[model samples]
Target: MPNVIEALQPTLEGAAMRAVFALPQPLRRLIAGPPIRIDDQELALDAQLLLKLQKLTGQTGLSAETAAKARAGMARATKITAGSPVPGVVVAERSIPTDDGDLPARLYRPREVTETGPLLVFYHGGGWVIGDLDSHDDLCRFLAKHAGIRVLSVDYRLAPEYPFPAALDDALAAYHYAVDNAADLGSSSDAIAVGGDSAGGNLAAAVALRTTRAGEQKPVFQLLLYPAVDATRRRRSRELFGNGFLLTDHDMTWFMEQYSPQESTLADPRLSVLLADDHSDLPTAYVVTCGFDPLRDEGEAYAKALSDAGVPVVARRFPDLIHGFANIRPVGHRFEEALFEIVGTVRAALELHKG
Candidate 1:
């Protein structure tokens, strides 16, 4: 039956993915290289893979249809190249009903977690436009397995269709859902966290701010990975690393236009979280930034803001890497190292909660 086939798809795909990664590491490198250098930063081996991807998907322009198709192809390629799922991580697909609609989500749990534990409600990054649950599936699985925490990847509505508060709404909805139904999702309600990379990071920060303001049960921790905290993009890093990096200023402009067509809304705290009046009382945060990301300064600025507000904050910046480096598989040991560091941070944060 179609339903049976649909249900079996992830298993089949995951198995195939594992086999592909089982090949010799040298061979994998050969397939994904040779690396290119841009400015002072040497591009990762995955840059070649991205070039091939660009050829396959064309320019991706500003159109929704082109972007969607390109995103799908990129996700497929990422899965093939992302090595394999972390061993002993169990994945399941589920739909959480929101006031807007039934929001699809994927849940990842470590095999050791037979009882309730920490839960990370994650939003996938695509500049609020071009990502979904599948796009960041491998990262979620890696975090869940390595950090020994449950990860719920939400498929929030994308922009040029939903726009602005829509994605924010879905993100907040998912976080609340996790808080309310933590037991059902195999997590302790008190140990819930919210995190995301890039635009999803923006959403996570916004949700954390709003939750604190609402006098609600706030998330225990915040994990912001290269979040786009400033919609204005006026920082020196934006000009310094705006081009040649994996994400260009042109692409960022396109994404911004799609997400917030009105220039007036660009300064709104929900969109530009760094512009928020008060950062006091936010949860402890782990903020990651890449040297070659245009959004790097804003992310650091946010961390500084949180620290100034007396919120415990851990901020790490990778000087040799570009935007989206943490999610790319073909980037070699550097990528693995960065990812492991992130997972370790998550583990430590959860353990503190347990204590």
Candidate 2:
């Protein structure tokens, strides 16, 4: 016999999330309290409410749980918030063969597009620990439908078990597989893009650098959403917006330790992409950051370095949004609005190429 309150905890939680958006915008704003100002930017009403709700839940950090528990909690959270998969997009489960074994993947496309075109090789964000293909399924579907291109969402190995370089190795392998089997995957080998959010974005940036330095075929574009580009930097954003935000500085530290146990590797360009001496020769990039994110400074720094290196880059920071907003659509108008603008930019940059 479960306690009645405990039995209804999930139901109550889900209802609370819905109730926030169910209210009139004015009332929601009122409950969200005053605008949270930091670094000359105002936090959006929706962000404040979500953070409040998060506080009520008392979920301070995933580091408190084992990696397995953290993953389970993340999956449950996604189920509560991510909503349904967008329709009219076909999804096919794929097994991308890697040196270690077969890597799981999901290929997404508009149901109408049967012919070959450009494709985005995507990675999911979980600080190299929690996220998986299922957690990011709606995100992939949203991108495929809205961006009007194919997306291959790869499930790379997680850390604390398969640590540094394993995920990157799997990422490189998936990209090469897409290139080698472009026809089968319905993508133009020369028009492929590499993209992801957070840790996934880190992998994408690393893949681009690794490929270019090796003189191999590289992605034509990079979609980096609030990426952890500098692992070693102690920036101001971390001090200001580190706690109370969706992602905490302590969480980042714990995640990095689990992923890259070697303190020596923190300075490696592959891990700390901002440490790369030259940002030249990298693919065209769209770097997105939010004013309230712990990774904001590093992401912006990477974008500036890229632009200074003469690479064509579109860097935009949504003044009011928080980190991980890209995948938190279906929760509120603000989240959906921000993601809409982002995919619009992605569509413009990685437009489908008929080849």
Weakest 10 consecutive residues of candidate 1 by summed lDDT: 56-65
For residues 177-206, what per-residue lDDT tens digits would candidate 1 score against the true structure?
A: 999899999987788999999988999999
Tens-digit lDDT string for candidate 2 (201-302)? 999999998998889999999999999988888898989888888898888988998899899999999989999988898999999999999899999999
Error of 2 at 162 (Å): 0.8
Report residue 163 deviation for candidate 2 (angstroms).
0.8
TM-score of each model, in listed order:
0.85, 0.95
How does model 1 score by TM-score? 0.85
Judge candidate 2 at residue 77 and give its lDDT.
73
Q: RMSD of candidate 1 to the true fold?
A: 4.9
Off by over 4 Å in 2: 1-12, 352-355
